[model samples]
Target: MVADAPMTPVDIEPLPRLARLAWDRAPALCASRDGCADYHRSWSMLRLVRAGGKPPAGWRFFHAEIARAAARGARRVLISGGADAGLLAIVASGFRNAGVVPRITFVDRCATPVMQNRLLGAELGLDLRAETADLREFRADGMDLVIAHSFLVFFETAERARVVANWAESLAPGGALLMSSALADEGPGALWRPASADDIPARKARLQAQARGAGLTPAEAAELADVAGRVWATRPSDRTGGLTEAELRGHFRAAGLAVERIACKPRADAPALGAARQRRRAEIVARAPG
Candidate 1:
């Protein structure tokens, strides 16, 4: 039994436009040799949208923090390395939920997500700037809040430090950096692999169910499941080994950011997704010195 309740149409209404954009564009992108096509194909807009544009855990805390930042006069926000509009929507909802509006800058290396975000921004009447840029080389100063979701794992171990340093430099004095990372034991290799062979089938089934629940036809859901399974089995995931809590804190400290909070917990949906190992999810909040 899928533990989550059935979603009402209103719950998913905001997603179809973006989903249409992704679905229409993914095939051409795949044919054009875009490296992220596998990801886009596997986690279709249906899947992403059905996931409710929120992290599996600690989302309340994140939402609260965003509201608090806005209350404290945070107006300039940066969303780093999101591959789609999901995180942008989540952040925008956070501000609106608190009756605040902040100017947002969203950066990703992929043009597709940039375009999607631009569409979302227009729909929301938000002051959003969408750009395609590598986060490692991207530079902007005086941002009041910098946010990313499950982002660090996408970078190799060596690149993680540089990314954090860049985020630090992008912040205004006393600005905050809020992010989440999956934590695991450090290993020599950086490649991300399925936790176990069972992980593939379990994840595929979940995706198929989510796709169906999001209103895809049975055949469409099955196709998505097939693509997701094949991609998971054959493709090298664009992710590196997870970071340890100590390593995460060290990086923030080395970047001269004071660690305000590091809340670690097992992901609520991890077991359902067939994560065999006990991977801890960490929500990090850090601040630059005044």
Candidate 2:
């Protein structure tokens, strides 16, 4: 049996009352029209991060493997966060281009993704199902590939361990999990609330300036700002965090997964996001025993 992993250092301050309430009510809250709008806006913002017409950096990191699997007729995939329906759609599009049709299952607790997937999946002609269910209560078996981006960060360590264990068990022998998120050597959970009024605007302005500096036209910058605003609507109540490489490796081992490949990219704005002295964004691929 794999030993328990060492816990990474985390700031254990209580979440704000409002944040706590929002977390508790997220499922219901996100079932509304407004929730759909929030997700639509977030995906638009995500496009800027990926520089349009390209897969997000994280997805690009593992696309080759996914395509190879599809080529081999291993076309069953589960994208764990329906909020990531956009990613699922993109993957499906890639498969279509290669003349391979894949079966996809997109799961999330929020209704927004479920609604979005129906529309998007139909438009893309992908065989898929979007499920809205609490991760703890969700179950599946024999998936060939699982993609979960920005999903694990929502849970605390013990809960994350449970969730990963479940996903690992759900994997078909030799199935793999591809995930990406930010990680820190030392810090509170990766979720960041604004530190102060001054800090918030300063960070926003810096991001805008960076966009402009990247040669984005004024109109493009304005469009990105609008998308960013919608995404920022939940920043005050965000509940996301990450683990160090060592911590992540330990977690994988404990969950009965073998680390297959891993990569990290230093974020230029890590400090602005309230990360500790050393934080890096990470992508990992792990596999179950065949």
By TM-score, the best candidate is 1
- List ranges where model 1 is wrong by over 4 Å: 1-13, 29-34, 44-57, 185-214, 234-239, 268-277
Candidate 2 lDDT tens digits, 27-100: 45475644454454345344434343334456555556666666666778888874534567556655554466
What is candidate 1's lDDT per residue for 1-290, written digit by digit as tens? 21144222224225666666776676665435447765665453634535654333445666778878978888899999765676776677677666677899999877777778888888779999998888988978899999987788777767889999999999999999998766764445442333665488888788888888877889878887886677666533234555677788888989999999887776554554333544577788999998
Error (Å) of candidate 1 at residue 50 is: 6.0
For all candidates in order, the CA lDDT equals 0.73, 0.62
Worst 10 residues of 2 by lDDT: 6-15
